[model samples]
Target: NAGVTQTPKFRVLKTGQSMTLLCAQDMNHEYMYWYRQDPGMGLRLIHYSVGEGTTAKGEVPDGYNVSRLKKQNFLLGLESAAPSQTSVYFCASSYVIGAGRNTGELFFGEGSRLTVL
Candidate 1:
């Protein structure tokens, strides 16, 4: 089973176009997250879902939306793609811990590259 996979390995978007990047996982994880990594910037959380049918805004959620309609899929939507939104996006997942130490074990998928101009 594929741990995690993202569609459209690369994409170019016009200033105001829209698109949805799909992320799928087979691990049955309880937590899923979307992050954007840019030059000189560490990974910043965009949106996250603790489980199916639940969603939450993250650090940089102004220009993004997310949905977890299915247990195996998490979708990130850009209503109006902008140059500021042009960054490498990564989808990650992990198991839920009641309370534990920091293992720092985050599973990341091959990122999706997007260019908005």
Candidate 2:
């Protein structure tokens, strides 16, 4: 089973354009997250969902919005694309965090490359 999948592996958007990146998982995980990786930088959290119908903002939530309507899908949207948003976006999922579980590990998709000009 695919852990997580993100559509449009590559995208190029001009300034002011808008787009949504779709993430889906078959594992039925209750925790899902959206992150962006820039060159020589660690993953920065954008948005996360602890469960269906519940969403939260993370470290860097500007210019982005998220929704988790179904248990298996998390959508990230950019209202207006900006050159500063050009980075590799990654979709990740994990089980609930506990002291002894593998909650510290994140299952990441190949990543969606976005170029804003």
Candidate 3:
């Protein structure tokens, strides 16, 4: 069902270059998230949205921006790329299975790898 899909599976950029990663989900989930994975750091949240037309900063929101204008899509933009931003980015979406509670279950995209030179 194409639970979650991330575009540009891999990319390389020079300092100051710009790019955008696209995430699309068909599950119509209420929550969407962007996370970056680095060695030994697991996954660190960069941004998230509770629903369409709403977004919020996450654990590591710097150097990145996100937009969720549509319920099925989430876009992550790097205005000016940097070496520190080189990592594997993942997009996830989930729904609340219970009343006002999240089970911490997420359906993730394949991942987009960004390399900054």
Candidate 4:
């Protein structure tokens, strides 16, 4: 049971609503990422953090905010939800396996499905 876990697996919100998705990992991984999966668009990175207390924007970060205040927790927040934001959100974590390089094998949570009306 020592892997990534996401809270509120399913949620529905109206336009302009706000919510936060919590991701916790007991594996002590150094890198954590938030991604959204949409029909035919595949998985797009929203935000990521390389270590505790640090975060950075990813490919699709316009409407999302992320925080990595603790080593084991990463939070993704939507300040204003929109219908276009409806998608399956995934959290992943991994650690570097070799010298300055990641193994590219991420442990993903069961995902959070969000629907905006």
Candidate with the greatest lDDT versus the true structure:
3
lDDT of 1 by residue, 1-117 (tens): 889899978999999999999999999887889999999999999999989999999999998999999988999999999999999999998886667643346788999999999
- Residue 61 in model 3: lDDT: 99
Q: For model 2, what is the alpha-carbon lDDT of residue 36?
A: 98
| Each prediction's number of clashing residue pairs | 0, 0, 0, 0
Tens digits of per-residue lDDT for model 4, 1-117: 659999989999999999999999999899999999999999999999999999999999998999999999999999999999999999999998878677889899999999999
| Model 4 deviation from the true structure expressed as Cα RMSD, one decimal place | 0.8
Error of 1 at 98 (Å): 4.0
TM-score, every prediction = 0.93, 0.94, 0.97, 0.96
CA displacement after TM-score superposition, residue 95 of candidate 1 (Å): 0.5
Each prediction's whole-model lDDT (CA): 0.92, 0.94, 0.97, 0.95
Q: TM-score for candidate 1, please give it.
A: 0.93
The root-mean-square deviation over C-alpha atoms between each candidate and the true structure, in angstroms, is 1.6, 1.8, 0.7, 0.8
Which stretches of candidate 2 lie above 4 Å from their native place? 97-102
Worst 10 residues of 3 by lDDT: 95-104
lDDT of 2 by residue, 36-68 (tens): 999898999999998999999999999999999
Residue ranges of candidate 3 with Cα displaced over 4 Å: none
Reference-based TM-score, model 3? 0.97
